[model samples]
Target: MSTSDRTWDVIVIGAGGSQAQAMLAASARGGDVSRWLAVDRAWRPETKATTEALGMTTTALDVLTSPQELRELLGSGRLVANLAGPYYRTGTVVLDAAIETGTDYLDICDDADVILPMFERTEAAEKAEVRALIGMGSSPGTTNVLIRAAVDYLGSAEDVDISWTVDVNDMTDAAARHFWHCFNIVDPDGTIHPAPSWEQLERKTVTFPGTVGTQEVIRLAHPEPITAPRFLPVTRCSNFGAITPIESLVVAWSLAFSVDAQRPRPDLAEVTDHAIDVFRTYRETRPATPRIGSGMQIDIHTDGNGLRFSAGADTEMAEATGVPAAAGIVLLLDGQTPNAGVFSPETLVPADFFTALRKVSRGGGGLELHRLVNGEQTERIRIRDLLSQTAATPA
Candidate 1:
């Protein structure tokens, strides 16, 4: 029942350095920082110093190549945060290792193609008595948990619409690659179609909090529609979002069509570089597009009654995504969540989720809630005030 002393309480796989750092900071805020480990494919002096600032040790690792070594370091601990990306490639690899080593797992996986396959591991995870939580990042993360809360608050849940927006200034190579690769659609019944995520993009307007005001969003292939139907009775669920400053989007889309069309997609570094050049070029001439970070709005309806929740304004991609993931981590560490089975974030207790998020994010994650009566905003409320109604309102 014992392994080497190299074990860690939590290991943050730094495929996305920003996300990994955010998680480390959050963990430091939540509890002991000594047991945390920051990992990447190669050692970078700057990264090592960053984690050290947060009081955590760092190491370089290619988990894909060194499974046994990774397993040893993982050491069947509290959990492994798979902050790696283009989840289509790295999701299952880290998850398999986590399950093999009897370590709990979490990730911000938003790829449509991977959810069903991961869920298929439910039996395996439960049998191994290890838990796994997927899609715990911003949109799929906070968005999914809020949907469950709204469903409970509104007394019924159906016909959910989730929309998200991220400032182009915060975009990363992995995020950009996901934008192109996530073109495949997932049905409410868990059937992923052979359609493109951007196929027939429909533009619609949504009002987000603070500087986000109202912005146009279109349907993009995401995991919500694929995974939500497995738990909620919503006849329809879909994901829509964009990396803003539509200026850069044009160049990105143009490049994506060419890059993705190649039988062997070119190194995504090309897309990231092109995106930066276009945004930098336009920033000088294009009218200002506020760098207010990212925002998410989820519309939930049940028996025609609707409710909406949103948070944004000056929050970057890493914090927006990593905070929720950190909250999920705290729950697992403190035994706030069950220790068996593979499941989505929505399955976690909403109040506990928000509570953990509030602690890690240091201010409730900038969340605001509202009640929509007959499709019109009728009342405004706070998360604490709304959660107070849980006991009074019979589920």
Candidate 2:
């Protein structure tokens, strides 16, 4: 089938690496292997081979340089999910292009700065009947969904704390660039502020189920808190995150900041490479926390009561961000998420999202839901089970 006719189901722009590859895998695992299309600025031959082996099509086009080509590609009605990020910049390529073409859009945009601007385009999306789901990655994406779920379960949520710990060893080039941009947050008053991620003053320690065990997390400049209050009826929310192999975040941040403070301002790409090299070397010499890959946990409170939910696996940066992105797209394509215009993951019905999340994960994401008693986990159940219990209860 032709893309303009009945052929392609989804075309992923900026589809060259692990994040896009993971999305393709999950989408294929959920069916429709033959109708996928891929585009990348620096698409490798092996990546092309991988796409072909999966009964897919791929082409290389720099989204930044080739606007017309991207517009032509996305002008069709097929769903377009962009995995390429550092969304503060790439949002122009994916989000703006989709909206301009009046196309439905999905992206794993983790930058809070971009999300705030995306909100301003709500009128355009609604006018064009576009359903733009941004920040579908783990920390911002699934984290937002899980927060929504807990809020729904608890009846109301006020103080919500979401923390994530990802292994530094899994940092990719795009991820590194994103690491830099997340620190520079944009406020509603148009003031761009720097987040104090490396400072020890805000350290909060928490435990996870795996080798990720327990680690200290500081406030991460992420999209959750920025986007949550806009969509959710919550008074307070915060996103805390840290990269592991101990003190790696400090080293990485120092390197990047040192370079940024240089005269004439070096390009962020160079800064990313330098920081990544040093951080990786630091991680290599230090004890490699292999089994302790990454994890995210959420604490939701209503009045004086609280509940906690955590969904984590021994996954890399890409899989953690990509899998749920694919799950969210699947929900949109399956007509489960029918709302048009701009929306967050929480805007989705919690039951539908968790069910698809479990399916796309192929039954491996360790999700736990528990009641918090005196700031301690009291009883644990499958996070998905909360949906079932909610179903059985009469409204």
Candidate 3:
């Protein structure tokens, strides 16, 4: 099974991560596993076993150093599902490799820094006739696509607010660290601009349909605010996230304070791993299954007119991120997404892509889209219903 000799329908980078696991699960469920390949620097026994069970194959070609290898690995028209992250460092390299290879690309990148630069490659991707979709994860991906739908369904959107809350049960070492790093990035605001992870907390209430009611969420630096403004017509766009059980906020604040103030702070991964170890001890002393669960929401508003809409889903963190990514990759490989240039999920994928994501995530508690008229809830539709309409309509 040599990549140089044969092309692949979808090649998933980073075979060992949680996002990869979810992508595999969604791909299997959708029966899109044929001709799939998983690539990593080194093959893990567990990942190999899982890929075997799913009828997928694995190969080793670490792109970290030899990014140009993608040219030989993926040829023109092939699609690469890049699940590797801490994307501020790795996203662009893989993207450049994809462009140089004339391959289509999609990733679950959530870093604003990574996304902004990738957008600059629009001309290069366009010239190469390759399509690249960035930030295709839950918040930035699903949330981004939902905002596009809301704007089209209601009218022009003046504001878009994205919020996320994960259940305590979904906590993982990698996720803990990823969440930690998101809080400490340098965000400027007239010299007093404190990063969201800088202990400067703001309290706001958020709801997840049929599950969570109004719960307090704190500000966090997420990529949606950075990319949403570029694609959607809006004056305000921001993202907030909180872990359920809420006490985790204290842990994050304390850890981030040390990392921010230390002269030689440990690398983000090291600090995040240590934080997870501490959290594990705390977890063992308590019972499993907290009351609330994981979910995310997108609030879209029209300024001064009081017209608004909110949409979201309640699910485990991995499914929340992976299902949407899997759907995006499927769309790209199947030629369902029409664009051939670098773009955000909101800018490139159509409303039908959101419909596809809703279907992909249906078993994971499904999705809900709601409308607010004059600051009050007006219309609510299950994602399944929306898809039914799409199905019934004639093409």
Regions more than 4 Å wrong, model 3: 1-6, 68-71, 185-199, 261-273, 283-291, 304-314, 348-350, 358-366, 379-395
Residue 90 deviation, candidate 3, in Å? 1.4
Error of 2 at 74 (Å): 0.8
- Residue 92, model 1: lDDT of 89
The positional error of residue 95 in candidate 2, measured at the CA in angstroms, is 1.5
lDDT of each: 0.73, 0.74, 0.69
Superposed Cα deviation of residue 357, candidate 2 (Å): 2.6
- The residue pairs that clash in candidate 2, if any, are 1-7
| Residues 317-350, model 3: lDDT tens digits | 7877899898887677666764577887776444
TM-score comparison, 1 vs 3, better candidate? 1
Indicate which candidate wins on TM-score: 2
For model 1, the superposed segments whose C-alpha errors exceed 4 Å read: 1-6, 188-199, 261-289, 391-395
Could you tell which candidate, 1 or 3, scores higher by lDDT? 1
Which 10-residue window in model 3 sums to the lowest lDDT? 386-395
